[model samples]
Target: MAQTHTVTIPHFVTEASVELTHLTAAYAMYGTPHIQPDGRSNILLVEHALTGDHQVDQWWGPEIVGPEGVFRTDQYCVLSINTLGGCMGTTGPGSIAPDGQAYGSRFPALTIRDLVHFEAAVLDELGIREVAAVIGGSMGGAKALEWTLLYPQRVRAALVLAVSARASAWQIGIQKAQMTAITRDPHYLNGDYYHTEHTPQQGLAAARKIAHLTYRGELEMDERFGTDAQTGENPLGPTLADSGRFAVESYLDHQASKLVERFDAGSYMILTEALNRHDIGRGRGGLNKALASSTVPTFICGVDTDILYPYHQQEHLARNLGNLIGMAKITSPCGHDAFLTETRQLVQIMHRFITRIST
Candidate 1:
């Protein structure tokens, strides 16, 4: 059985009231904190990607968070937070407002900095003034980058894998299209139709389908699905839906429906816009200044086959940051999703990186 702990921290987000609202953060402590009785806790904050929850062990396997895993709870206190704009047990746009209504379209626009600020509040509530390390992947990586900028002294080290310092213009363009697909649906009702009779299923599914293609690489799609038909129905059939179905289409449909069941459309829109507006250098300075500002030791990882966040982006992080301790390049055929699929390699990288910072 996994030991669980929940704590409520003060959170006054841009979307809500000015008064400090209670926020919930769930965590599982693995090992004891490496500190004196009165000293600061040796915490390792693990940030999750989009659609990911604090159930990192469930998604990746027990070895990644167990007594022997890189995060060995028996040796270190590990904390993973569900981000501010996420749906997984955390306070998000899908949550009920103080007036018992869902924030829905009324949820404020959240930046990556907003997420970092809330996370810092979590630490404050936990009596942790500083962390031994902060680690994340994908959008989680973006959060890690923001953390280094917002709380440089609080973090002694950073581990960012398979992600970019900022969302590219190309990435934002795709995100806009996804948002358009959802809003065009008559059921969306400008994001406040959650309690209504109809929900934006078609638009949400279409957006997911579009996103599924980018999450994978062309080579992976070609090798796995190719141009083969899924339903085996003749193209000359009467109805278009039954006329022809490609294997890739079937795969995408499965992925789309899965997200529709687990994720809220309103939360998706809010998070998507946040991602589109993501630029770590927005008010701070350019990438160089942002990286230079962080004094924490850094570990960067890149996936060779990733198309969404290419390997060069990792190189850019390592080059711009002055205190880079190591760079791990994962060679996988799984593309951008390799960080999830290639668990062993990720564990090894994390183990080495964490060990270096602990001592």
Candidate 2:
């Protein structure tokens, strides 16, 4: 297990000018330190996707970053920080406010840039002047892109997978529906149900179910389940209420229940909202202009079957970015979550990029 470290940011202000005193950022480091004399580590900063923490190997599996994995510990120092709005050990909605209450609904709005800024502060505290590479997928990918733009001199290279330069209306609409599923639950109590006996577990589960559909590919789902009834249960009965669920439904329910046990509802909402607001071009002219301005070498990859963030988005990023090395494609049956599911392909692409950057 990776040990957690924290840095205090006194009087931190958000992009919206929301003031937070004594802000804390929790991070975890892996790999052996290869620090230079100038206070910088040969570090590769790995940002996590939504609902992910700093436990990269634990969450993403050892094959992605283990000793013999693509991100070999002996090769480079790896660090991952929980996003500002995350729940795991990080100061988020679950954290206590100055008034001795959980921030919950009162947690300030967070933009993707705010997350980048918070991590940058933590990096400064760690005496890391620059990172060899900053890599991520999904929301993580957005942050990786932002790091290159926000501190072009600091990020030597970036590997962004399964994300776009801006959050699309289609993506926002899906997220809005998910948020609605949570807020509509009475137990949510306007995001202040922390002290209550019951949290919005049902709503959270439903939201997860909806999100899972988007995360996986239709072909994969069909091949896996294909309207088949769950074992020992009949799909058809006298009425729909009396009928047992299909195998796919059971799988989604399991996924939802798993998340509900570990994740806080308020944190989920806050993070999803932050992800919805992920626009790299915002306040920086436009998407093309913002991307074209970056001199940092970039590797943009996308899953071919991804419905949420399709291959075209990566193509656009590759075409617009000034220093794009190449646009790689991960051909997988999984959809948006292929970055996580297809580890072998991801490892290959990442290894290639790391090798190229090192050379």
TM-score top scorer: 2
* Model 1 per-residue lDDT tens digits across residues 179-291: 99999999999988868888898899999888777777778789998877787645455788758777788888899999999988877887778777667777767887888
Best by lDDT: 2
Candidate 1 overall Cα lDDT vs. reference? 0.80
- Candidates' TM-scores? 0.92, 0.97
Instruction: Please give the CA lDDT of all the candidate structures.
Output: 0.80, 0.89
What's model 1's lDDT at 217? 74
Model 1 off-target regions past 4 Å? Answer: 1-5, 15-22, 26-28, 31-38, 235-242
Clashing pairs in 2: none
